[model samples]
Target: TNLLGNAIKFTDRGSVRILLHLEHGGGAPLYRIDVIDSGIGIAADKLGSIFEAFVQADTSVTRRFGGTGLGLSISRRFARALGGDIVVSSVPGQGSTFAIGVACGPLDGVAMLNPGQVLEAETARLAATEQAHWQFPAGQRVLVVDDGPENRELIRLVLEECGVAVDQAENGKVGMDMALAGDHGIVLMDMQMPVMDGYMATRLLRSQGYARPILALTAHAMKGFEQQVAEAGCSGYLTKPVDIDRLLAAVADALGGRLASNADRAAATPQAAPVAAPTPIPTPALALAPAPALVPAPGPAPHAALPPLVSRLANRPRLHSSIRKFTSRLASQLDAMDTAWQAGDLAELAALAHWLKGAAGTVGYDAFTEPSAELEEHIAEADSAAITASLQALRGLQARIVEPESPADQLNDIKAST
Candidate 1:
């Protein structure tokens, strides 16, 4: 944690990453955890004593970066106590790498995570089990239309894991073209974007006689927005920062009849929420003799307690590579927003905000999501004060958007594309 914290604090540009690998030595298996940072690097001269208490590369680094410098000393002592050592390498201006080597427990018992874990977790939270409930049958596909790369990627990842193939389009015009050009179980459409928006796209698709379900994805949840989208010919409406379950449920519902035609798979429709119906209680007035002391019935075993909120993307192996790609581009995504905002391109800014709002939340960056949504809303409302405040909040999160490389990656620097 200390190493990661330091890396992020000094890395104003580029990235911070964690790398891990198994090292086979003379007797034991050693695990190496490397925290790499593209930050102001330490000089060769200071590398020797830099781990000492209250020490840094120089006074200037201390003043500029603001640290009391106890983190490394404490970390090293802990590492040494565990029969491991923390080490560092650096190029004065480019970056630095800090690695700690430690022994691990036996690996013979290690197993890949089970998919049942997802069911237990999801069922505990949503009170809905049966993983097969949302799993589409063979040859099933859904068309996902959104201008945001992250949004499209997230939906694609989640759907693909459920046996549903996906086709993607970036904006309404392209989405409209694709919708007409192909056959799909359903179309998930983002209601706002450049070069055209979802409402127009759906309208055009409908006018042209394309009749498959088109589910509207929008951030706007105002009083009459549902009716507005319905009038646009959307089969269903879902608000943004799209909940994984809701998206799955809506798509499954849209694919209802289609599921029946494919491979003997049942079309699973979610039951109406139980809250919608009131359970009646019989008056106890006539219950004499304490209801005859009835014994409790043995029902199903209790489910595991609901775990911490996990992203819909979590628990799937397919998500790893996509997250790496998203993380690598995070800096430039922020850059795009700044440029759009400076140019007073409200449409462009709103599109960017819309993407950030959905993508960040989808990717487990909860803090980044709400502000992104606020910025989008303010831009739409043309409220200068709210927009500026939201922009500032988003700018603060930019510093925190540093990508922590997955422990499974070898800690390679993800070079930003030129």
Candidate 2:
């Protein structure tokens, strides 16, 4: 269901066809279902591994598909639990075929259909229902593990506001301690952290049989992480700047309880909490994050050799605001274009290119978006350089935006260097 759903999502002009080949024998019929799509294809070596659960061919696919990777793994488990299995094959430039084989038999007779399992499945179903009167109960707890203060605070703010009580740990060690000590409904785990990252923490949790949901929260919302996260025993995955709606939906689905998606975990009206004085800083004409340590560029270049200069300047408040606005807007724009490219929407591709050109240039990314603008002007000409260069710039920008420190800290770095 998850793979098919994503196939439909990412395939616009192409056809998605499901072929069922059924055969009768061995006192039971064999039902073979093949979901074939001319969408983004998986690489040859990865074809064998994707069914291993949470495995995707590429990171770009995960951002486009927006899934936890549990869907296919769970689906496969369901198939196997019924004495059936799933097989898959694909060619990177071609397409993919997911073949699910099932034995025809009375489900009640299946040993996996016990009453407890039945009840748990039904609870999950009810929890997934979109009914308004169905309240899943408040004070339900979740353990959030992240090394970054901003990320933890953002998640804490979002979840606590939803009436779901929240607990937090900055590193894996603390997270494991709290997780093992308490009976929480779920764990929102960050994959990378200090002392003990989420991957190790989850491994430890699972080894101890902590059955509640454990979801991976990371900026690397790529395909492979899903399977990797699952190996760590996490139930699902959530990308950064966590989408409130998707997060709640996944949590509700995983925890067997319903929660309001509108309930922002981070929302809170300040009461007695003291407000700190705001510091002022200069906003370059274009605000950029400190570049990443390793960029996705095609070739090798000293990461620090990249240019670090101001495009324009703003007041202190504007500088802070501009940085946030700058980083977020570009990330969102690039992400959208990637989605559009996958869907093969030329119009959207053109529009995104145009928008990026305008926004990047406005914020001093002319060095980046300018090439893309020229490409947009002659998309029919197939300007690969423009496209490749633009992508490289975006990659470079991601590094800059997510420096070892905050944009605020980086600004100070710039001042000190100056």
Candidate 3:
């Protein structure tokens, strides 16, 4: 799929072809699939490196064609996992072809059924079963505490459609107050915030005998972050750019009193067993509501103004309502960052950079990810000049983000060209 998809993506003027056939060797069947594209072909020297993770043919290729450069690497791994391998051949100005070969073993009882059909059926069954575990009981309410208004609004919109009442707080202090005063069935707490961080807030709530389930919401999907949240007394953790299905499912599991222990939460990965759902409670008066259509807001004017939010959710009305507030908050953070740098306050600068990096990506300012990362490295090395230079570059990128096209549009254009 990856090879074919890539072929289609790069071949703007010509055709992409797929050829599949079976061959026999040593009295055993072998299947071969070839994807060929008349696209901007790979340079001979770069062909091998393209299959390596995060190594595109060239930096210019990556800039012109957006990808993390991991698709082919992962696809090769998958082919190898299936007891096969993928090989590539290309010419600099002509085209490229990828071939995959897999062993075809004898089928036993299920010989009558097509393998693809059987796989699809089993996948659908598992999806249905997983979704069933995310159905919540009646009258459940969830609290979302995040400094970013857009983040909170997005969560609220998703949960409300799932028949869950959502209340918001701008920071952990307000969140702590609400958690103590209100009877929330579960809490989605942001780990990083201006007033009292989520870790401290969670600790306070735990110490004050607030027993409801708490799930940490964070953009830092690093090694120790989940364990940190678990140690702070959270039931589970969800990383941002939050997936709507996963968010609702986590809440449902928490509301159903199926929270995982700290140890389990710390070690858990996506492939781990899902939390068990409790017996269904009586159905409440509320019913599932259809989500509204997303329409993009007016683009921001050019120049020193903060860039408009450019996420997958940019067109969502609920998220649009919080855009100004989100941008304003980001602007203030940048100003504070400047102050911290001038004052040689490395600690403050690092903290602000960390917060800005997380919040910027959450609100869809993906251009900031790299510069923010660079700023963090500069701060760690105590390189003031490099930090200043990176900050200026970030501001320039933010200012130039006027009316940038959404990734969805780019994808559609690629499909049309193919």
Candidate 4:
């Protein structure tokens, strides 16, 4: 809060103390934090209007302590919004203490940490941030083997930013051949893919004396899965909802050369096409093109907002830009899924579901992944009734989303070329 900052600014020598107190009342617990400081104290008259907007102790104090006087006002508003208030006590020429009390609804299931632990956690986070800037080898190629076009595209777009060339394989069969033929630094192999999954491809490659690192990608994080990955001859494994930093870290671990912090791709070879910044398409809504069969809307409509699939990409701007393309592709996949369902092709249905399971989460349609995976499970079980039910459930999930009014716009032209 501003009180702490203000205290720090005014106090030149003595220590500033933050004392925390808690009380249990009729309702939720109330937390009161007192920021005490040994500094030039406020006059008794000024204490009355100190909480007022743009008002500080005095001109001399302002000359000594520089701040906009906005942080306190905003923080006061927030405190009141939570059914609390901030009060201050000071003696002229002595010191000042400001206390804020607020009701915290619940502490259930929260992991509490002390100041030392928090500082340690912050230190680790900074190290990860610096490591993210640590460069991979320039012009090093990484092979991405997966059936989902969107998944492959997501991996390619991220790696290319770090000066890596990416080659795609729709299935493990092709991945094996590419691994043998190309000079790739590492392989990111998706486990549940069509035409020879990652396990078989890795086994085949290792059998043929291909010594490069093969990292398995899977949605399954069940207990004891790492043993299976080791048995499959993978160097390690990564899970779904493809995280950008985790992907980079995995590649770093495999290559054993995480050096440098600032460098661009070598201009000698062009990187993969950069995804355009998200802009409105001509069509208002991006999903459910050639709309599939669906049941009635849900019991309650979801509030209009960015889906979790897309929202998580807010930090990775380049990768985030591909959202429009992912939604456009989603419509086509829905149509294909419907067609496959009409013909009762379980293998095709499961494959489409599997792809959707990975693709939906990658592009911010995370809620869609559950339904897609459910449909895939039913198909794998070879239960026609469950498959039909699960298919309807998937269709219903798209139907429930409330549309945002003209969310993207005039930027459509910028989006189209990509």
TM-score of each: 0.52, 0.35, 0.54, 0.55
Q: Report the lDDT tens digits of candidate 3 across residue range 1-418.
A: 7787688556544467886655444544556787877777788788769989988897765544445678899998988888777888776555787888777675233223344666765665555543442445679899999987668876787677657789999999999999999989999999988879999999999999999999998877778887898899999998766666577667767777232233433333223222333222232111112222223235554233333536554655445544445566776778898898889899899887776666666656665665676578778877656677777766666565433344576699999999
lDDT of 1 by residue, 1-418 (tens): 8898788666655677886666555555556787887777778899888899988778765434445567899999998787778888877666788888776655553432334654554545443232334656678889999987878988998888677889999999999988888889899999987799999999999999998999998877778998988999998888777787688878877665222222222233222222432222222121111111222235542111112333445444567566556666767877887788778899888877777777777676665665676576567777766676677656666554534347544344444432
Worst 10 residues of 1 by lDDT: 284-293
Model 3: pairs clashing at backbone N, Cα or C within 3 Å: none
Candidate 4, residues 236-322, lDDT tens digits: the string is: 888887876789888877666475532332222222332333221132111111212223334443322213233456445576556
Query: Candidate 3 local accuracy as lDDT?
Result: 0.70
lDDT of each: 0.70, 0.60, 0.70, 0.70
Off by over 4 Å in 1: 1-133, 257-315, 377-389, 401-418
> How many Å off is the CA of 79 in candidate 2?
31
Candidate 1 has what TM-score?
Answer: 0.52
